[model samples]
Target: MTAEAETTTGSGTTTTSGRRPGTGGVTARRWAPGTQVLWRYRDNAGGRVHICRPVTVVQDTDELLAVWMAPGTECVKPVLLDGSPVHAEPLATRYTAPRTTARARWTGAGVLKLARPGEPWSVWLFWEPGWLFRSWYVNLEEPRTRWACGVDSEDHFLDISVYPDRSWLWRDEDEFEQAQRSGLMGPEQARRVREAGRAAAEVIRSWGSPFADGWEHWRPDPGWAVPALPADWDRAPARTAP
Candidate 1:
């Protein structure tokens, strides 16, 4: 995973930014093209994290790459042909579908930001593995802002996210209120989250993944070893001098 550029929020620390360009048309590519190459980078604190997820690049334009991962998206084996992880740590994070959330229930897109080590935000998108459904992004998730796009499974959309400090909270008012008390977001961050709702609505209008029977893409074949979890998955990250 790579940091395209470090963005400083009005707060301390850097807000790394990456914009998933607006998707093209379904005819723009193909829905569920192939196993797409996914680059994930995650750090528990400020150190390297367990990494995995790789796909071969078949075609790449200056803007996009037609990629695929062998064994498809379910290959959780810890090593690739080069002894790298089938998946790897991520730089920042994208969004994904939550396992328990019912589809078509997205109120809107949202965002959150924490400069220090703590729970990040939750983000969701609509994408497919075999083809590219560029019009809309699918998948729903909690801790939504912690991930980007990865693999589109057959049963549902499988997304990647940095381990979250806060757990998944269905769009209940309690969770919304907690986000306020947690000091995880600021006025600007909250505004961005609100704007994210536009993307969510757009995906819906386009009938994308998790929004478009993405639940069908959720099943993952249990084969290789899934990544091991840190001793504490829910602990907020602590800032350390690099």
Candidate 2:
């Protein structure tokens, strides 16, 4: 999770050039649907991976990258060093407290993550146990940097929850503020993240492509197997041309 130099696109997705998967040659290519890849997030204080989920590619193209995290998939997530849930810790010490990674099954409903290349945030769709449409979560963060293994980004600690009625509410403002106070994010970075959140709100208001698209009815392919968490889940990702 080294901080590699990145170029930003007009839409704000991060781009870099490096090695291609399967081929020793350097090139950018879409991951075929059903391909298993790791979607990871680097720790806020350090560039080490703190969150990693193995997902199956639903669709991949120049416009969007869609991945499905099936229920019960094993994943890595941060927890208090004492083995408590991070959220259970008080906000005052949440960001500053020491933490470690833990492996756990992705309980509850699966998630469908949709990201337009260069967008500063990704939209995650959720459902209830019976496939009942729940809501869309706007995760404000750095645009994903594509690599041979998968994609990586740093979470901004801010988010938006969009309901089925098209209504939305800001989420994690306290965490965002606390993250800055804890020095995990600088003032300038926080400003950019706020700007990014606003941009996402604008899209939600306008009822953009993803929201307008009928993804709520979409279902995972019955033949697609749940992707397994790889042994090297935290392996360094090789940059790939966008």
List model 2 lDDT by residue over 37-118, tens digit each. 8899999898999999999888876678999999999999999999999999999999888899999999999999999888
TM-score of 1: 0.29
lDDT of 1 at 176: 30
RMSD of 1: 16.8
Tens digits of per-residue lDDT for model 1, 35-96 = 23332333222323223334333332222223333332332222333443323422122111
Candidate with the greatest TM-score versus the true structure = 2
**TM-score, cand. 2:** 0.89
lDDT on C-alpha atoms for all candidate structures: 0.29, 0.87
**Model 2 bad stretches (over 4 Å):** 1-26
Alpha-carbon lDDT of model 1: 0.29
Give the Å shift of residue 206 in candidate 1.
Answer: 2.8
